[model samples]
Target: MNRMPVEPPRIPRRNTGVTPSPPFRDRLMALSTNLRPAAWTRSGIAGGATIALFGWLLACAGAAGGADEVRAGAQDYRLSGEFGLSVHQVGDSIVVRWMTDALVEGSLEVTTGAGDVVHRDATEAWTSHRSAFATPAEDSIQLHYGDADARHRTWIHLAERDPRPVRITGVDSLFVMADIHGEYDQMVGILQNAGLIDEELRWTGGERHLVALGDMMSRGAEVTPVLWFLYRLEREAEASGGRVHIVLGNHEIMVMLSDLRYVHYREMWLATSYGLGYDRMFDPRESILGRWLTEAPAMLQVDDILLAHGGVSSDQLAFTVESHRDTLAAYMAEDLFHRWGDTTAFFDIDSITFNRRVDFFWGDRSVFWYRGYSDSDTLTAELDSVLEHFDSRIHVMGHTPVPGIREVYDGRMILANPLPLGDEILLLVRSEEEGRWRGERFRAEGPPLPLEVGHPEG
Candidate 1:
């Protein structure tokens, strides 16, 4: 007797914005495997009922742009945490545009009054085509990113919008590591020595938070390992009730979008050995680290303390913490580098223009790329005012690499970048008993060495 095809489970409508949990992801994988044969029918895989149903469900859950033609100022539609779909009606045809930031290869299906129209690109860049429907049927447009492998599959719609403010308050101890520069050994060693993780690389810091202030991508041989190690640590830390906040840094932005001047020679060799381009190596749809990094925030708030790669300034004082949180909303990571090179400020531009073109992530002085903190004359007074406006007591950042960890402006701003040459980890412990934050430098062994560098004198 021929075995009947098992019915594929409908994608559930839960936690619509974040990454799918392991169990749900596993179920998705199982469904994909079970439905494979049926997916190869005459009208092609795109015509499969299972694929169509999956797409339709995603369209409904993510956005409500199916029947209603997209108009000006229509609500932004979200596909996942990093993918967004927008629709526009121009004359008779409806134009559809989707952005995932990472390189994606997938199928775009539009069910119109005429028939089912499908567009396929094996290597769709960060954005999808603006396919126009002259007489789109009443159904909707469904965009499926990632690939046939369930490992990178992502479903997006045209109506769902979820903007969550990222904020954390009240933590006893916070350990931050910045600018690893592809030094995986140093990263793992520092974590182990700090007792944040064990020799076996498991989270040992109970309830404490570890924030890696980005730049884990450049200047080293083990870029891949560094990316995945932190990925593993993130999950492990969460399991232990601790948290890992991997704030994006300038170097990370550099590597993700094909900028690789600082990438080590060995890494280039490794990519060539694998026959993968740097961009493909971290393609959000193809690489786990690429996808995970896409989800990382450019700046994060921890109680009264603000954490960013580059230091914040008075220019940013006008925006609220919530606004700062929204800066990363949908396109910051993917578009920042494309629109402007590293280190371009947006001060001369009007607020409205700046807000439309950029946010905390881009511009000469973007949170991820700014280097003014080290120069006291350029930022001291303004930094003080910005910190006060945000009600942020202290700011910890790491874009500016220093000979050693430095504290400027009476410890209001702390630079945590200890390049591989420095051979030290930046550690900040806020003891419940002490009720204050303090920074120290550490090796792979004993207690943190005293911070000899005093606060910069104005």
Candidate 2:
């Protein structure tokens, strides 16, 4: 039921469509924008036992955030269990990629949810096993990677909603979270508060969509565990007849392009230990998750609400949703994975904005990094047309964090950013008691926070 490809696709050197005046490394200081601030401080993962035993890489990843350096020391730390396991849908088959230190055969075993053994195949280390059943797995398929020496396993979610679709409708219940920034334990606690997952982190909220509006990785040292957890959660939720949507965030773009300024030093050390660069951790040629992530979806329409990491900007008002998708696909297809230009180091807007007028995926004006929504006048002026072009009643986005969850422009746009640990989250739920669908300001602990759009009466 499983096969391996000769090699994964390559991520070529990108051409940003702009000529550089000087070497990029030279421009790091003079043309750079302010380094993004680090995430809120968090200490100690409570349930550390379930986290997969992953390893570190060669170089120091980056300094820690919030003004403190990652104290994991300057030593190049390397250990075992750096398997970045992921299950990706590939053409009619499912490919399971598990990172191994060396080539070893007969290391894979797969089982059905009903306890039927489907595949016991020999797998090469550092490569994935592609599972192709005549009739695809309907719900879930449990995979056990590694043989007796060292092993890791999980059940892959396979309800199969198109990760990028034009629209999703008929969803009466959902949870909205933003900017996790690699705080795994805290993110789990937030999910637990809504009864979305059980104590074991298994999805229990049936048919209710949970959307993370982006920035799932970076900032914290536990990015590895967070990545694995979301991978598992997405599948488990899908199997439970629910869905988990990960809108692409600026951080996601940053990490993939070898920009590790905000990535934790521990994370850098972890990747170096595995004999790989921090960016290669998710590079399509190196990891299945990276292969999947490369084809990015800038926006997702869920029922009447549109989800994006950064809200639409004034410049994007003229483009249709399909036009945006086509553009994104074209860029990814051509393997145009360019890093941010020298002029505006941190996305599109440098303090100078010198030679930087980037409108592509990596630019500040692109969907992942735009902050124009923070300006009420500009946002309100263009909000209606943007929503109408996208065919959504509300546009929910994360990137520019507000003091609290915001329902701005008369609820036409919702901002869910800077969502700190135990902070408020926006919710859309079908309230049986009220006989209607409603939105609310929810938190992990304490009573529900008040929201003007609590009852949409839709």
Candidate 3:
């Protein structure tokens, strides 16, 4: 009997203003062996009808993951309590805060790197515990809760805000992946296969920078896990001399503005269960991951490549790297934080839209949302203009999902979005001899393949 080929079930994609991904453009691997990462093909694979139906059913069930964890968390907040905490080290004091159902005040035990524990009696400062520790922890910090009968611990630490570089001059090797969209397992698998991270999701890439072109949230069950992984991965990458650059995407902005349309049911249920609407769950002013979102750049240049969520537009060709970072959307973040700047500020989506019409950043042509690069009508000259303005050879962007990894204008533009994990990730390395970054694609448990694999147009 011949085996069957099956396309993955169609999950709804985030609103990109363009036609959404088709119901079954990409097929799936069997649930038994799990993510073998089916090699994408134009011709359908030969298989039995029964197997195809089985694959489709498996794909549909994949989206509802994390049910047990969500249920356990609903029963006891401690199970999911780490997400509610945010730690920031100020001038001489480290400020700690957490989201709680009711006013919470208790003893906050701090454990430093040297194995010393300092006990501080925390006082309620609104909805969560607020404490300013005189000791500065640039590395690991453990927060202890509960009494002798039962002990609970949540480890928290954030490296200094030295990330978000607009331009990086020298870098030999770089790993580029785009539009994670909460596919945490695939993200981990692909990165681990590339030798960028270990099985534990710790960065072992060593001086090798990792670039995420954005859309790290919404659409799947592992949204929180992905964010949290990247959060720690960023810090670990920095400590190992590698930097993790995260470019802002439309879905991330949508979450910040409480536009929760494309988010997975698991995350939505958690927010509702905790009474944290979308914004409060990942609020830019609170939630450690939410705070990191504001610091992420909309676009940046590394060596000869320009990385952006959506490729830059014609008018934006005149915008500088810093200007790209200071779009009105970014301004809205600071303004809203100062004006309302409280936990109660979320829940109101209307007040957070920030005049999307007038702001060029939120406009269709802006960096965070533009999709012109994917259209064949987009002139090569316009792309060349972008290259000349930024003095970069290639534009690496995500937003418009290419079937896999696509190279247009004979390799001047690459669109890698919403990593389906089918085609896996694209790796670009700086070639000192050629004096330009070269591109290649990598799939699950296999050697690197030619860039041509992703470009069927050839």
Candidate 4:
């Protein structure tokens, strides 16, 4: 049974109650202290009470600045100058208002959190223009305007800060594992047995980061334990100054969408008995998994390592840095999920193809199912074109499972699939001081499978 698509709830804009302390605290404290010995003390007390009351009122007012009222429009909008304001639903376009004194020509760059520039325009004071931006991500529109007489500049942060990809520095190695496919008990056993993770399932490497490439759910009987273990490992890694980056896999995508194709019978039985269909079990809109997956990048790069669930197409490699981020985010949004399992979309030659190729449910050469091909030479050539375009030397991926870790195209890429081991494998690529990367594979060994148990055909 295919799992249903679960929509994540819309993000609400509300005061988190984390506000900065008043900058004039010393002066206010001094005044309060000085007035304690005179009739001015009572007056000061009353005055302070009044100010406190007004401050509370202002805080309440600021809190009530609801996103519901902020319609996307062409009208000029501004919050009070004193607050760190947020503008929601700025329509399909957002116009930055500049004071006449702060006008200059050719000095605005709108960039997303992934550091993609969305719009670049030259303007004078009070300029208004339509932004190509539609959906929101962590992004900012910076303005470089004003004259030599009085320099002025400002930036409007257009979205909330995302969990920025942390740079893993000072580590000699990095490991990536993917598509464990619901074999969580085996995964945990393998990691503990191998010593890559402690008995408690925490990564033990200094300065190293572990990336679980995706597919942490489905097929196996112990999916819940596996997710719980990884969730714990995520916290542990962060606490130890190491990192665990979990990307989205097709199985996860299935659950998020309530697509029952990949779900095991036992899991489905439990879900159905509880009156919870696949959608309710894993709605991306309401589930923590949904939010986390939304933020996962389709591709990641570290030193010489180019990590993506599926290989990039030739055209995508040609995108400018800014365009790539926008293109990828647009591909990952919910609407694309509506079109899952559709092979025609994946094979479209002119489209970006990340969603179709990387995010889609099934295809011959897709990450989830590609086995060796007689056309390996042609595939290699296409991949070479993309890698050369990005100036990258080696690509590591796990979408297509291989027997152990295998090198292809004379080591232009390494396919790391440690799924059957019960423990996720980490590929530690050690970078030399001069910045060359060397690969080392780490497997978490667990209790051996029963003799009767057979490996899945990868």
Compare the candidates by TM-score and give the number of the best one.
Answer: 3
Between candidates 2 and 3, name the one with more favorable lDDT. Answer: 3
Worst 10 residues of 3 by lDDT: 2-11
Which ten contiguous residues of candidate 2 have the minimum total lDDT? 49-58
Whole-structure CA lDDT of model 1: 0.57
* Residue 357 displacement (Å), model 4: 10
User: Best to worst by TM-score, what's the order?
Assistant: 3, 2, 1, 4
- How good is model 1 by TM-score? 0.59
Candidate 1 lDDT, tens digit per residue, 1-458?
A: 22112122221222212232234344554655665564443223232345434432332222222224221112232222122223344455544444333345533454333444454444444333334445333433444433333222222222222342357887767787888877767777778888888876778988889888878876555666666567667767778888988888876765653445455544443343334555555654435456566667777788778888887766677667567656554554443333232222122333454344434434556776666776554566778787788777888888666666777767788878754432677677776776787778887667888654643443
| TM-scores for the candidates | 0.59, 0.66, 0.69, 0.53
Which digits, one per residue and each the tens of the lDDT, describe model 4 over residues 350-427? Answer: 233432433234443443333332115347777777677766777666655544665566667766665353334655
For residues 1-458, could you state the per-residue lDDT of candidate 2 as single tens digits? 21111111111222312122123323443322233113211121211111101111111223322113433451322222323444455556665544443444426677887878777666544422333333255576777775457676776645533436546788898788888776766777767887788898788888989887778777665666676677777767878888887667877866665556556666665554445567767764435466556544777787778788887765676666657766665555432244321212222222222122224544566678766665444456677877887777778888765667767677677777633532666787666686444667766676657564321221
Measured over all alpha carbons after superposition, the RMSD of each candidate to the real structure, in angstroms, is 20.7, 12.5, 13.4, 23.8
Q: Where does candidate 4 stray beyond 4 Å?
A: 1-171, 318-328, 331-378, 419-424, 431-434, 446-458
Residue 89's C-alpha lDDT in candidate 2?
59
Q: What is the C-alpha lDDT of each candidate?
A: 0.57, 0.58, 0.62, 0.47
Q: Give the TM-score of candidate 3.
A: 0.69
Lowest summed lDDT across 10 adjacent residues in model 1 is found at: 2-11
- What is the lDDT for 122 in model 3? 52
Ten contiguous residues minimizing lDDT sum, candidate 4: 78-87
Best by lDDT: 3
